[model samples]
Target chain A: MTEPTLQSDLNSFDLKAFLTEYGRLVVAAMEKRIARYPEESRVTQAMRHSLFAGGKRLRPILCMTSAEAVGGNKDHVMDVAAALEFIHTYSLIHDDLPALDDDDYRRGTPTCHKAFDEATAILAGDGLLTSAFEILSHAADDGLLPAEKVLTIIAGISHAAGCNGMILGQMLDIEGEHESLTREELEDIHNNKTGAMIEVSVFSGAYLGGGTPEQIAALDVYAKNVGLAFQVIDDILNVIGDPKVMGKAVGTDAELGKSTYPALMGLDGAQDFAERLINKALQAIVSFDNKCDPLRSIATYILTRSR
Target chain B: MTEPTLQSDLNSFDLKAFLTEYGRLVVAAMEKRIARYPEESRVTQAMRHSLFAGGKRLRPILCMTSAEAVGGNKDHVMDVAAALEFIHTYSLIHDDLPALDDDDYRRGTPTCHKAFDEATAILAGDGLLTSAFEILSHAADDGLLPAEKVLTIIAGISHAAGCNGMILGQMLDIEGEHESLTREELEDIHNNKTGAMIEVSVFSGAYLGGGTPEQIAALDVYAKNVGLAFQVIDDILNVIGDPKVMGKAVGTDAELGKSTYPALMGLDGAQDFAERLINKALQAIVSFDNKCDPLRSIATYILTRSR
Candidate 1:
């Protein structure tokens, strides 16, 4: 599969401009909704800090972009998109706890536990996680979609967040930490940890947008490819990207002896693998109309982004 | 507000029969569902141990009794009942972790982290928590209730388990460990920790049983009283009850200098308080028919149980 040239894709659509606009809307909505929690508790404040801290709202953007590609209103997808961001944020907060990653820095800011206390950080993660489903269940009040479809979307979100997916991924990641991992072992970890929620972002939008079975199926393929590509790029960035651009400490993967795409395959080979996956993602979107150009550009952006 | 005599209220209710029957069913169903995951993974096995370890299936029994009080089928409430147990069990597993309670025993069996590892116990708790919602969503296939009600029940369960409720209680409990707590402060902690889920169990069963607004209102009051009384009894038992019956260490509450109703109110004052709450619980059920006898008896039983 031939990958789309990043230069040409950037020229066709201002990738940064689109992401920036969508990213602003996504982050603003997430922050506003999270802030709606009563401000009395220190835990809620800590949760808001972790949630609103500056990171590219990539998951929510993917959700909104997919909805727009399917001709659904972007406004209709805002709450759902925010809900995706909540799930993503919750995962990060939990992952950074002392029992988990024990990282002090994330996105150039102190992690939730470092900024607050460990117990507060744990509760903050729990708050964000439960709030994600709460937001999804209430999406029907927006009147942008039918109640049944909203339920289906919630179910999809629940499944992705549940034991069969992201939680399982975290479990495997913990287990694999002290043990050496094979290529297949590493793939399985990334697939659950990152791939599950990423897939849900697109499929949930497709469901809300009233896509047919075939479109939903096609979007799943696209989501899986992009998800894997996203992780591969992350692994590569950890090894070679500028610390200023990447935000957090880089090369920690090698320091921790964690398995990575570049570790299994050399840096050049890992880049090739990411490029191949990006092409596959693009191919999955071929049946869609030109509205899907954003999706294609985003896939290319996955490979080309500095952060 | 005179309390009903224990012999008059629960002497004939056969508590052993209820506990044994419901306990077996709850454990079997939970074990079967958890075992569906690959056993080779240490985390999955750890999750199973935490889930299956011998504990009184008190929450599910409360749910079943609540369903019966409304003249609803026992099987009708089984899924949600099981779900409540799962949530309770997951919280216990997480609470027993080194980062949390750091207990080595639960119900006379090894704590999850002791039986497995700390990381596996964490993931196991995560898996179980997420699976509770999954089980509720899939309850539609059981044909006992409409999907919409199931969704509403899920929403309520999420709210209780999330930050404002049980998790909040946990945060407060941890914070209270080194501090002197006022009576109001202790009430807030107990309300969020145990009372939230206890309240939800009644509401969930009522929702499924086609309870009227008045019945639901009445049950809410009934639940509040029993939930608190349940905690008061637990506190008393910690100081004076037989450890053989309680299954885990007793007096550890005082050893840890934890706040409790008895600790703050004194034994006689706590007893008076329990009587007052039990009377309030009975008053709430005065509007119900003879079908409410089981609910009334259970409230009385809260004061009389040794373990």
Candidate 2:
């Protein structure tokens, strides 16, 4: 399929409209998957409460856009996109646990533990994590991709989200609490904790979309820069973004003594880094034509997003 | 490969020797897999602590034995077996959390939370859960099974282990604490919490082993009965077995006001029920020849085990 006419008309780009149309699709897929369980059950209720809670649905959107950029079908990637959201949501739930970030609210509402109990929240997180794999396996069964490719995707995702990836980042985050970290150490933490999953999200989409080796390599480069920029922006937001706009309180990273980009680099320096990274991200995808505009816009949006 | 002579030599069968030989293989594989991570890392250390704590490698053994019973090679099923143990170990780590059963020790050693911090313990559990999928994906990559079959196995296991299965069971168990539960309610909890995963373990093994539909169905029935009996025997052991022998405390269920077979039924009645269940388990596989002796022996061993 050729690039959509609307995508080529970049001057008329509307991030809100784009997200609304695509985000609804992602949310619908997520809801359909979650609805398969008994709705009245507490665990189900807990899962739905957090899942349907407000978020921008960025990861799933990124995944779908990455797939489309590679000339892959959106229908074929929807399950995987939803799976990414599930994993993302599960991580948020766990991060809100009393033992972790201990946040009372997320996205301006009661966190899972605050909505239910700690035990229920933990189970809900676990249920979501396992459910993500379940959904991907079904995607393979549904012939979204060859089973071998799906298996490869699953393995890649597990590694990215597992100990040496997101979990490692989380471990480093917890350990770094109250301790000062060098810029390098902080980069290592964010790369593992937040960047790994984001990179995998994009890589998974490109792979499932049947991108060529060169295309996948370019997207990987693009995703890494985007991921780093995304986290840096997050750090900047925590320092200055309004709580209401951001959907949660700001400055908690500093309050908790987290090793954030703004803490390691000065605020202006962190902002400069995010801008440079986004430029690099756009440059990595320069070989692709208008078909990849969504990715390009997303890199720009990551730096400019209020939340 | 036909049944090994030792498996057919029922008169001279020694469960200890059999478990020793096979258990070593399962444990060694598990150790090798765990060793892939950074050795000195805290999360890895926490994961290894519970993983190598010397539980009877029953689930993995069941997986391998089921595969063998169906004429599939052990090497083909080893990764799945190890994945099962990873899931089992992760569940134990979570179950031992302060918000859950609050056990200080498992297998006569400090629980993960007690040994490591609670956050590390939680991350360890998460790491193991993700790693299980990672290993299975590798199994697919290694050509252990057709990718389609591997995807099917992953879906089945997730359904059995996720909200509707193990997590559901766990949620029910937590909610039922300090409350009176009818026999049916308790059964539902155990069936989901314990039986679901066990059933999946056997089903995965049988499916991956290329079992015929009839063979898989029979194993499912056998697994259901064996799983329930296994839990029942666990209750009996808690009430009567020595702590040193069991390698954990006894009577905690009763103390927590949790329902058990011995609670609803008298001691003799519970024991009788376990015997009946084992017989039913054995009967399910009776259609097969002496090649199925290990399964039959496992059923008997479940009833007779001290731990």
Candidate 3:
């Protein structure tokens, strides 16, 4: 994970440089906004702890890239880009609590509840959840997009993160823990749990970026394919990824008795499935211009990334 | 608590019918929206369970009442009024968790986590929190208000529910639990924890009701005074009010060893303080016409309410 090597078929666009540049902007936006709150608050500290816990800012990067791909300035969607990260971080903080997954560490550091206490972690998640909306709605104040469009984006993102989306997915995940799940059940869980937010991130950025109906439709297809591919790869990595390369513990998913792509299918079958998903995803965005090269590169990165 | 009594001087308006009519609208909105989700989802059931768990729909009632008081149709702020109730319910679900308040019951029924499991309750809270924003943002699609105003309302409400408002208040509540708190400290906690959302509920309704600056200003003053008075009344009820009338336990605050107005000041002192605050609240709205009588009656309602 130290250096992202282009180990897959496509390498025309340098994914590393793309991530570094846009990811920095996303982090800067989040840091600047979070800095406005009081430093002495324990919940703020807990939020900061999980937020900066060394993970790739892939969701926001995908969003910013999608915005640019559709002929919009990345700056226009920067607040929302940061908001995606906040939502992800909040989910992680809550997921790691003792009543849920109960993980002590995330990304090689203490989880929010482990770093602080359970009550603080819970409130920190609540704060970040609220803060994400604050960022989303305030995007209208700067005239970043039309107020109508801002409301549209909020509706879409909130839907993805809400009842039938990520929350439902999380509920399904815990429900399937004790029993062996069929391939369909596992995919259903991951599709709702992980794929929903990822797909909406791409769709939201494009819609807010003023993409045409056709272009947004196509990107939605691409997003759905790629989002699932990303999770398949994550499951693959958890089973076989090197700890040094992944920068986190390996085989933890297996240890947790969780259903995963590799667990459902053999390693080779899982990898092949991931490859097919990437191919389908790339096909969906074939008509977009070279501005979408980052999107193309991300598809490759999903497969080639060792982490 | 069973029948509204005009114990104080300002019972010119029918407060019971006001609550019944507006509260039913708020509940209907919530029920219709929630019905669209999958019935089999445990999270959905958990959300429904706590949401329907019969408490006074006071917050949303206040918002709708404020909108009416400011010369706007109550229907205009109905969605946001429902959103307020969702936020309040979400906070209650999370607050009652074992990691937080650990309460087994609310409104004479099992708490969310007690009715379902902890994980389901947590996700249910997450669902309702996100759904609140979904409702807030989508109000624009119905032409309920201008998109800009919708965005403004979303920003304001999210801020109140987020960092320096309710979330901060909850964090401070736990932080102050083990120690004797000054009156200022206790007020700060109640102001943030309970007062922030309550005050914003008033301000948001007034703003969305198309109140003029002068009108909104006066209502803000009224809201702040009544918000604090409401908390003081709650504290007094926990001390001496009948559980049969309250339909909830008495002395739970004292059991928690939590900070309270009655803890800092004697019961008589707290009662007198609430009276002064209610009077100030009444005086702030004195310039308004009879349309604001509901606002005035609510001030009296806070004092005379046995619950």
Per-model interface RMSD values are 2.0, 0.8, 0.7
Candidate 3 structure quality by residue, lDDT tens digits, B190-294 = 889888888889888898888899989999888888989999989988888888777667898888888788888888899899999989999999999988888
For model 1 chain B, give the 10-residue run with minimal summed lDDT: B1-10
How do the residues A149-206 of candidate 1 rate in per-residue lDDT, one tens digit apiece?
Answer: 6667776777788677898888888777757899999999999889999999998777
> Model 1 misses residue A102 by how many Å?
2.0
lDDT score of residue B132 within candidate 1:
76
- Tens digits of per-residue lDDT for model 1, B114-152: 888766776677777777766776777656677677767
Candidate 3 chain A has its poorest 10 consecutive residues by lDDT at: A1-10
lDDT for B145 in candidate 2 is 78
Q: Which stretches of candidate 3 lie over 4 Å from their true place?
A: A1-4, A7-12, A244-248, B1-8
Q: Highest lDDT: give the candidate number.
A: 2
lDDT of 2 by residue, A122-218 (tens): 8898989999999988886654478888888898889888988999889889999999999899899989988988888888889888899999999
Give the number of the best model, judged by TM-score.
3
What ranking emerges by TM-score with the best candidate at the front? 3, 2, 1
Candidate 2: Cα lDDT at B90: 96
